[model samples]
Target: MLSLFPQILFLAPLALTLLRVVLAIYLAYIAWYLLSRHAEIEHAELPIIGHARHGILWLSAISISAIAALLFIGAWTQVVAIFATVISLKQLVFYKRLKEILPFPPSTCILLLCISLTLIVSGAGGFAFDLPL
Candidate 1:
């Protein structure tokens, strides 16, 4: 089973970049979903920081999408990685139970946290748009 997994050290940068892009899309989707289901979602006691207010959700979605775009283009890699790390940390701090969905379990949040940290340390690598086109 272990053989099926890629060598973490050898593929660290690519894995981190992929994880960052995946997380950005996931965060954007969650924001849009929360905004759409504000009444139902906010019925539970939510942290003020994680409130499902329209403005908050919209800003979250936009920011997450921007991060995703930056990650995709491999531009401002460190900055976007830091921003993602902050947002993920905020989610862990303020909204441990941000979702009740099946596919998006708590472990997913933890994985995102790890991914952000990896990107912050390893960076986007040679394939990044940071190089001349």
Candidate 2:
């Protein structure tokens, strides 16, 4: 079998690193948006939930901010990625109702979900705190 550009294969881990950083940034942005504009979000019924509560939104924002920080540093990456995947899945499932509260659109949610799944299967890639056990 003939191969081309095999030398660049060593850098594959960096690609995962990049995905992690981007996903972290996106989560951070969502948290920030929720925190900054919580007051403006009108009361509405969220999917699976009868009605959205202000306190719940506040708690979610704070928790997401923490998750974003953990993800940015690549600490407990697989665990954090699992959380991210669940959040993204929720966003995708409730896009219609959540669109008003969330900053990004449904497409971005799908992308984030994909990234989270990758990190979960790949184990945080390079420059991460999660070492193989």
Name the runs in model 1 displaced over 4 angstroms.
1-13, 42-45, 49-52, 96-103, 131-133
- Alpha-carbon error at 62 in model 1, in Å? 1.4
Q: What is the TM-score of each candidate against the true structure?
A: 0.67, 0.87
Local lDDT at 90 for model 1: 68
Residue 64 error for model 2, in Å?
A: 0.6
Query: Candidate 2 — which pairs collide?
Result: none
Error of 1 at 48 (Å): 2.7
Candidate 2 segments exceeding 4 Å error? 1-3, 48-54
**Candidate 1: which pairs clash?**
none
Whose TM-score is greatest here?
2
**Candidate 2 local Cα displacement, residue 126, angstroms:** 0.8
User: Evaluated with lDDT, which candidate comes out highest?
Assistant: 2
